[model samples]
Target: MKLKQFIAVAFTTLCLGAGTSRAQPVELTFANALSLPQVEPYQRAVDEFNAANPDIKVKMINTPWVEYWQQRRVDTASGKLPDVWLFVPGFGAEWLYGNKLLPLNKYTDADPTINLPDANQTMLKYMTLNGKLYGIGYDFNGQVVYYNPKLFDEAGVAYPKDGWTTDDLATAARTISKKLNGNGRKVWGFAGASAEWVFEGWFRGFNSRMITDDGKYGANNEGGAQTISFFMDMIKDGVMPIPDQKDPNAQAQSLFIGGTAAMALGVGHATYIFSDAGVDFGIARLPVGPAGQVGTGLGGAYVISADTRYPDAAYKFLAYITSGPVLAKVVTTGVPARTSAWGKLSDRMTEFAGKVQGFEPFNAVKGSFQVMDIQKRVLSEVWNGSKDVPAGLAQIATEADAALAKAAAK
Candidate 1:
């Protein structure tokens, strides 16, 4: 389609009924925050959707993650938001509560081919809030520890198993950190100890809640203190590095890719990076603490703007891209959000399939993003040993409770 034609179609906001016909195909603006290299798979799915449905043409709007939120805010205020855009449940709470996203329940109810029943219920539940479905999840992810077996072998430590305790993890980590390579290159035992989501995962493992079901702050107790102490001890023991608090994910990924970290806590998508780097690793469920195994879940979905002119076409594209087969093929890094796609996943993450739960409890609340901001800032101090654990947790509780109360007032 020509640029002019695409622009024209994007502004043509007629709600076409089911089975409606038109001489020209409906075009939609599909905005995504994925970076250039990471988006090829999604682009391929878009191409497939455009080719198969001659009646709909979806145009790509690529915004890298660094500038995505800023651009999205500008677009939203100017009434120029894309017809369909990507949504992250906890991170996009501002958009959700502002009522800028179109509810998908009606469309899903009318369209059987969308196959609402086939999606992972855990991911689907996150996409819905206050009885309204805002988006259809395409992929699901959670923080899991990926370990280097060679490092474990060299250190004479047993490889971490699915049901391993946090104590078992500490033993392996401490042992591995003590071993140096032939050239005397130091290899840390673990990375991602300071990452916000990874920290959340450990806290979950300790049965600590960051946010309660009632939407209040809940991480200021004994469990939260123990979780903090655990990771702090790891860093103090020289088993983990003090990561860049602002961008711990990148640092964690870098350490693991460089083979300087024997085991790293990362999201399910980090497998792709490890594979691309030719790193030898084994996936293990997060270690069990008193609460049993647990970790933080994060994922993305396709959502329509409430201001969209082409709701029908947008819904069509949303449904197509998020379907089982397309997601199974395109979402190589993360687990597809459809139950039927589970069988197609490779053996690397097969054990995690049906075993790990990817729903993040904080995403259930109204001001989670604000709460997370508080978490990231305050916990950085705690992680660096500049602030006491008890003090940090108390500050988080105060700030997060205030943020939630403010959001509730709105």
Candidate 2:
């Protein structure tokens, strides 16, 4: 329970000066879901900010990820939202449509200290709805392929390079698995490719998409078949595992970390996980699809509530936390939304320098999570050989279209 209860707080000092002393500093409630090591840097930043600004104090409320979001929804309904909180990316449509957030464009535009351009446009795009900015991004994640070079060398397989295509990925995976198998090693060439987020990239590569431009399911066609077929072929070739249905993400990560898998499709923060495992890995941009390279992209941003009584003080803290210097220290998992802060990351994440700039968000559509769930169920059947690609995709499209329509009706 201690892991779930970590909170960041700093004492406020009433400054002694000509007509500057106040009975109480303006207190702002700041909330985030980060726990443990991730929250350490964030606490330090809040303490530093509180010490520097005697007039304003930020009290941090930290909770586990699911509990935090559940609490946020309750707070939003009760009209008692935090003065400022982390605006998770996928919740954009829900929060914005529900009028739970205050548009920060005026604050960002007027503040001379705010570096709007330092934030990645993709992250900003998620925050923006109808041309109005809702928040300032603190950090972001972009997808990439993580490969173990030691496994590659041992298997005598050449390392994957940027701009490699799906065909190229298949070849490399097959070669590595084949060579390692011949050597009596139990390692598979890749893991986690069937993950919904990772699969979205391959969907793009094969000129298929999860949703149409009009926001309906788009994965019910030839291109969708090709993408599904490609993944099925990888499994049939024994290059990748049939994903763990209950939690494919964890399964993929653990397999790679435990050395049973040689490569994985992951996001920017995966460098930390792999590095902690002492794996010498190489990061490559997502492979090129028939159309072009693309993947799942999103991150967290700082947002003020529409109900906040102290917008000015809240904006100050938002700007402070999102500033390059603070983010360079606080953001340990993903790339800082600010490109300027990336230089502070260790060399192991060097592939992230400027590479995330090209990454664009695909899963930002309305009702995306609903559609993603449908894909997971139907695709799991396909991966398990219970359904053919065409039938699986048709089911996905049918079920996802209904879900999207139901969401719209709401």
Candidate 2 clashes: the total is 2
Q: Which structure among the candidates has the greatest TM-score?
A: 2
* Candidate 2 residue-wise lDDT at 326: 86
Please, what are the lDDT tens digits per residue for candidate 1 over residues 153-186? 8888888887889998888888888765447678
lDDT of 1 at 389: 92
Name the Cα RMSD for model 1: 8.4
Worst 10 residues of 1 by lDDT: 13-22
Q: Lowest-lDDT window of 10 residues in candidate 2? A: 7-16
lDDT of candidates 1 onward, in order: 0.79, 0.79
- Per-residue CA lDDT of model 2 for 217-305, tens digit only, reads 88788888998888789898889999878787678789888877888877666778888888777887777788887665777888889
